[model samples]
Target: MEMTGKCRLLGIVAALATATPVVAADAADVYGAPPIESGWKYQVALDGWFTALDGSIGLRGLPAADVNVSALDAIEHLEGAFAASFQATGDSWLLYSDFMWSKISADADVGPFGGTVGFEQEQVLFTALVGYEVPVNIQNMQLYATGGLRYQHYSVDLSIDPVFFPGINRSGSQSWVDPIVGMALHYDINDRWFVDVMADVGGFGIASDITLQGTATVGYNWTDTISSSFGYRALYTDHSDGGFRYDATQHGLFTRLSFHF
Candidate 1:
């Protein structure tokens, strides 16, 4: 009997050891939800605001004379944007590819010229990001910073009214590859509700000068599937020609609605 009892105890120990891995795997799957391998997200936004532009225009080699003019002015503004992102996640790392298009239109009156200028800027960015969640007692709060490369295209048109300049139209398109950097703070009210604030800044090519853009937003997530946000954005650009300089500033309020899958 003693021999049989000892064998039974040994058999129980072996069974528990064999079942340990299976139990642990099941617990991990239940507690540590993994990110989807692939998914698509889309967003649309509406924006409105005021803008100010300050720059100097130089006219050289015109009728054997050089003319330099400085302008400081502001305008009423309106804008919109659309964005889509594809996501990839790992145990301790996450990657996202984002494509976004933003447009702004405003009118400014300077000197004897009363005209409207509009700009549309678009970007496709790919980033490999690594993030760590803070070890706070609160659940679902994360802070992350990302740096990557972005390809940007900017289109601008300045139209002078017939009252200002008989028939003068100025328009140009520029594209460049630039470095992008950003930071984000996200808080989850629950599994299906959250808020985020994000900011990004970058510079384009040599001729394009330097540019900075920032935005702040409050948002809500639905069913871990859809999101809607309202926010404000500001942009500044310092552009220079061979002998001329153009400084532009724009600010606006925006609303965004997005779907994630």
Candidate 2:
């Protein structure tokens, strides 16, 4: 498969919490430390990921094409992108969910007729997980075992302009879901600083042959209910079906602003 061009939209989470300030309270602070209240805690977060794409894609029995697009290179063709996540935490159980959507356009020489090919693609990813805290002796730290489902949808449009034959246009979409299991670790450096790490693996040849993701971030509390973090994240997926194949890795800087209640 001689695939040519591919671009993944990097999300941007605006840290608007600083625009307005709130009094810091000690009773029930969020982010780094555990909640003091006995009731459930809720969190909403926005994220930005400026990633580089490296992978291969094939369609219609064609040879797989190489894809290498940088964040700067994708900016010109990026149409739209959005990403956000939600969380609910209890004494020893938690629920987390995330959603991301992106659209981009690219050009390549993969056309069967030896002409330029235009490719437009839109992708959506949603993930949800339930976790239970694992007991440990360490103080100011927590660990959780997590299980979840990941859903992916792709819509692609292709245009091929051949020298002799009429132009060809095609559009199609595919959707699939995968089962995943992982672990999360959160450690508080102090009253104002913290670190978080998470890793997951999925697929088991059920949907995509295999999928992997990892994230690590360091955050600072701005108030009892607001915080910001910056770190790195990497994700990889491999899947093939009905003459369509996508095996790619996206890795880059990750930023987030979170609100707790």
lDDT of each: 0.51, 0.83
**Per-residue lDDT value at 35 in model 1:** 40
Tell me the tens digit of each residue's lDDT in model 1 across 24-119: 878879999664444423333333333333333222221111111112222223255455555443343445455655555545444444543323
Model 1: lDDT equals: 0.51
User: How many collisions per candidate?
Assistant: 0, 7
- Choose the strongest candidate by TM-score: 2
Give candidate 1's error at residue 17 in angstroms: 2.9
Best by lDDT, which number?
2
Q: Which sections of candidate 2 miss by over 4 Å?
A: 1-37, 108-117, 158-170
TM-score of each: 0.57, 0.79
lDDT digits (tens) for residues 214-253 of candidate 2: 9999999999999999999988999888877888898888
